[model samples]
Target chain A: MQAKQIDYAKEKRKSTLGWAVAILLACFWLVLTLTPFVFMVLNSFRKQFDMLQQGVFHMPDPWYFNNYVEVVTHGFFGYFFRSVLVVAVSLVLMLIIASFAAYPLARMKFRFCGLIYAGIVAMMSVPMHVTLIPIFKLTTDMGIYDSLKSLVGPYVAFALPMSVFILTAFMKTIPKEIEESAEIDGCGRFRNFFMIILPLSKSGLSTLAIYNGVAMWNEFAFANTFLQTPSHKTLPLALNQFKGEHALDIPIILSVLTLSVLPMIILFVIFQDKLVKGMMAGAVKG
Target chain B: MASKTENKSSLAKVRGKRVAVAATVFLLPTFLLIAVYFIYPVIDTFVISTYKWNGISATRTFIGLQNWVNLVKDKNFWDAFKHNVVIMVFSILLQIPIGMLLATFLDAGGRKFNIFKIIWFLPYLMSSVAIAFLFTYALATNGGIFSSLASLIQGKKVTVDLLGRSPHALFAVIGVMAWQYTPFYMVYFIAGYGNIDTTIYEAAIIDGATRGQYVRQIAIPLLGPIFKTACTMSLIGSLKYFDLIWNLTQGGPVNSTELMATYMYKLSFQQFNMGYGSCVAAGMFILITVIALLFQKAFVVKEDY
Candidate 1:
């Protein structure tokens, strides 16, 4: 009986240890994932003096809100809108171009579809550094080099390769019979493409659209290259300005970080399920 | 009426080729864009690699394989290449085990897994730029989170300026990368686990396979495709890695962290050595292409008709 009691106690201890282990792992992961954002948000609320004394953890005693106030009045809001416009225009153009390209590869029989797909995937592997000089040179030659139009053009081009593949893969799941029946009607090829193919491709288009949207929204390299003018700079590029060449302001810096992430967070919360699923799915293979 | 229609159909059949031609016309717009944007750029890059020119000065002299020769000799190119190799190895080593375990552990936890899944993936999606911003504080020397932890663990106030030093710089960079991408692999592992037919587990259990053995044999094999694909994708991503490292280190602390892509960028645009840069670009393109093809052949299986 004494032996039995010892075994029982040992089993209980084992189970308890298991729970502890699980909780510990969970806490470790939670701290890693959440703390940075929590730190950013907390630091954004603190005054500059308080920010330096603490490394973003000390609670602001007065709960200063001046960071947001400063960001708003500083005309960074205009910079934010510029980011929106660029991302939006780029997103729409990419979808249109990718779909236009993808529909043929998916539905219509093309001899070089594999080659085309390979070319696109191969391009993804090509370092952006490789194309930077030529693209810039090309942009300058095109006369809209520093303008938003020039920026949008290469974006649509770069985005086309992957986005088209994604759409084409998705298009494979679409019933070909619909296109056949549409073809039998008086509808011409162009009309069928626009009316039938485009209509049926909504989910695929949206998924690709969100990928481009977020990418363009956060795009740094090209914007840094093409849009050197303060008026032309997007949010990511503009955020770089908060810190001068050498000097740094911790509170304002934190505020910029907070502001950069806020739109994405809001977007995540709003379309949490769809956005996460779509983005992850897109990320995996695309 | 049917007979007359048939006669008319033969005449219309001649026009059917015209219709096919018109149908092909719909594809022209997109095809042209791809040719210009993707196909042309590659051709242009290859052509540019042969010519010696500083981007702006308007003189292009033909130089045969000189840039390629220079890249092979350049210590900077080698350093960048080695840096990427380190990233690739660490990517495989760090991501696979941690991701696999987290995925498996979270799987057994069931409903609890949902919250943790979201929590883990949240960091993966956090902007590379933003994470760089935050970790600057987290890993700093003066009572920084990492520094504080080091003090507590070692029972002495330890100091390491991770960013400033070469010893820890690459590790620190990979640590952030692991923090970000581990979730990416976990998602695949969890999904792969879920798809395993239930009877296989029962058979393994009846045969007296332990949990560890079962995971090693069954789960790993089944998750192989995902592992292979992720490995290749992440490797390619590692080879051309920019943004995160760029945002994090900027190939900094005396060029200790430069990858091939970042170096190529600096050479091409920053220094205006367009000739040598495109050669490096072509080199990268060839290397990536060869690897991708080898990967496709070796790992990613396609059903041959």
Candidate 2:
């Protein structure tokens, strides 16, 4: 009995030691993660030349707000609103088309069901760079180059494969009997989809919306390639524009970076659980 | 009886035709968009690779296989590809293990450690462009975070030239990539841990297993499929990495950090070498597809629940 007591004490000591190590490592990573953010935020409040004079960790001498004020007044919201507009249009179109394609693949009996589903799923691994040159040519040829309309097609198209794959999987879980009962009331496939399946897939649709929304909002390659005019650029390109305008003023550029990232952080904070759950939904393989 | 059977067969035919029509209408838009954006562009990239024309030119010469030959011999292209492989290997190595460790910590500590999860996930909320710009300033030589910390430690002002040097630039970029993406894998493993049945933990404990033993033996083993998926994702992500590197360095300082995507972007967009850039882009696509398929075949992760 005394030996057993000793073993228990030994195990408790070992577990406590393990916990201590884990906590220490966690705190170390926390510092590593927050230091850059602190640098960005802290330096953004300093005058342009003051960043060089003071230590990085030191507080801003006078806490200047003019950088932010300059950034906002210099068409920051134009870029912000354009991004919002493009993402909204592309998202709505992507969701509707993805759900439409997913419905038949999930519920209906079709001739090329397996082949079609496999083809769409395969496109997920095709890197966007492969299509960059051709899309650029196509955009210019169509006379929509450097316009917001050019972004819509590619955004909707690229998002379709993953969205369809996930939504199809989500729809498969929905019981078949719900659709059958609606069909028995003399409803056609179109009505059955609109009235029964579409409503039931709300949670799945919202998850896709969140997932694809984040992606389209932060998209850079296509935006950088297609949009050249400053007026047509999205939020992701705002940093470049600001940097170009103020080549040496680091504070103004940092303020622009902070502003661009602010909306996403705000959205994440308000929809924390939903956003996490949405990511989980996307993570599950079909 | 014969008349009734005839009538039912004709009705069934009509229903089948209607079903086909419904399916067609439903799938048409998706297929059309994909054809324009994905399928046609992929085919067009290969075709354009065969020609020698600037992107804006209205005419072109059929260069045939010359571009392909040049790409095969081009030292810069191969160097960029080698950089891509390095990033892929390191990303899989660093991000997965560290992320798993973080997730395991959270799983062990449970609800009280939710704050850690929140803080760890903040990096991922910032876009790649934002991260690149933030780190550009954070790692700068003068008054940067690293230099400041070093000066404090050594009791003297020290400048750290991370992004400007040759050998150090790629690794610095890799470290930044890890900083940006580790949170993703952490959350991924957290979800994986959440998927494990609680009964297994209870069973292990009943069998006199410690919490550490339970995680090491039962939980980690069960996360095999998830671990493979995470690795595959990191591999593909690293190969096609563009946005952060583009914004951060533009593959600069003697082409040390040049990746396939950045190289192709520079050729096609910056230099207007459309034909050669198309070849490079096509080459990258082929390599990624082949590697991903081979990895899938090799791993063959079975969901044996």
Best by DockQ: 2
DockQ (0 to 1) for model 1: 0.30
lDDT of 1 by residue, B1-305 (tens): 12367778887666556554653565566667667666677788888999998888778999988888887898988888899889988998988778877878765565535777777767655566667766776677764566756766899768768888985888899998888788777776776666666567656756766555667898778766667667777888788777777767888878998888877778877888889888888888777777778877866454232
Tens digit of per-residue lDDT, candidate 2, span A53-111? 88878999899999999999999999999999999999999999999999999988768
Residue B162, candidate 1: alpha-carbon lDDT: 89
DockQ values of all predictions: 0.30, 0.49
Per-model TM-score on C-alpha atoms: 0.85, 0.95
Quantify all predictions' global Cα lDDT against the true fold.
Answer: 0.73, 0.89
For model 2 the interface RMSD, in Å, equals 4.7
| Residues B1-305, model 2: lDDT tens digits | 12368779788777768777888899999889889889999999999999997888899889899999999999999999999999999999999999999999887777678889888988998889999999888999987788888889999988989999999999999999999999999988888887787767766766788878987899988888789889888989999999999999999889999999999999999999899999999999999999998888777745433
Q: In terms of docking quality, how is candidate 1 classified?
A: acceptable
How much does each candidate deviate from the true structure in C-alpha RMSD? 6.1, 4.1
